[model samples]
Target: MKEEVTQNYLEKVKAQIAKLQSFSIVRIPREENIEADYLSKLAIVKEGIIPPNAPIRYLELPSIFALDVQVQAIDYSNSWTGPIVDYITNGTLPDDNVKARQLKI
Candidate 1:
């Protein structure tokens, strides 16, 4: 059912794409979009952004074991794809036997 909805949406999108002379879609990471991110942060901190009677309770935890303030995650220094790409390109394996065996499997 989800796939059918996706296919229908894609067909509509393709029809629109055909009508356009030129268009490009580029995904910007949230961290890279600092200006928009700053605006959003300001809006969230403002009191009465929503009605006081609104049942929604916003819980922003700094850490799982934390107060309302939390720090951003450090960006992936060694991303998940690093090991996989190394294994495929140069047949490199982690020094740990367990991890190398798991990768093979």
Candidate 2:
């Protein structure tokens, strides 16, 4: 019964996608879909549905371009630090004595 319901829902989604003028459907491995699955689980938690355990997997996409220019700029500007050991040894941000300013719109 559950499988039937899921199949029906997937069929409806496919039909709707077909009706769209422009779309690209990309199949990704479960490992590659972890981020989206995590967000969906977070949404479920927000809606008051608690799951048994937190998801353990993570997906990272290094090659795909992001629309956020600020993130891209930060990625380009930052120098690559070797590992967590390097960070623990040397990384430093602004101190509390320095006043932080928020950008105004």
Candidate 3:
């Protein structure tokens, strides 16, 4: 399940990357970044010292891309959701316009 969640998040990241006109991802050496040293020290401090003004957010769902595992259960064992799931998750659909339109929903 953890792997599934990670993969789902990765797919979302890839989708966002697809929309970029241009971008670059790089790594900075910790030795050259003093902020990294300070942040590491801060992690050793006691927990829950957050200010009341600091907005505390909680996740009700494991992730925004939570899997709909029961989508295949809609028809009582018949696998009608395969097409829709494929369409939504992978952007894959039939070439026919009508079929693609139906899957878009």
lDDT for model 1, please: 0.68
Give one digit per residue, the lDDT tens place, for model 3 in 38-88.
566556756855433334456788665466343342442246776677777
Q: Can you rank all candidates by lDDT, best first? A: 3, 1, 2
**Which of 1 and 2 is the better model by lDDT?**
1
What lDDT tens digits, residue by residue, belong to model 1 across residues 5-50?
6676677678769979998999888799866565556567766475
**Residue 27 accuracy (lDDT) in model 1:** 80
lDDT to native, each model: 0.68, 0.52, 0.69
Q: Supply candidate 3's per-residue lDDT for 22.
A: 85
Badly placed stretches (over 4 Å) of model 3 are: 26-56, 66-105
* Most lDDT-accurate candidate: 3
Runs of candidate 1 with Cα error greater than 4 angstroms are 32-105
Q: Tell me the TM-score of each prediction against the true structure.
A: 0.30, 0.27, 0.34
Model 2's C-alpha root-mean-square deviation from the true structure amounts to: 17.5
TM-score of 3: 0.34
TM-score of model 2 vs. true structure? 0.27
Q: Give the lowest summed-lDDT range of ten residues in model 1.
A: 61-70
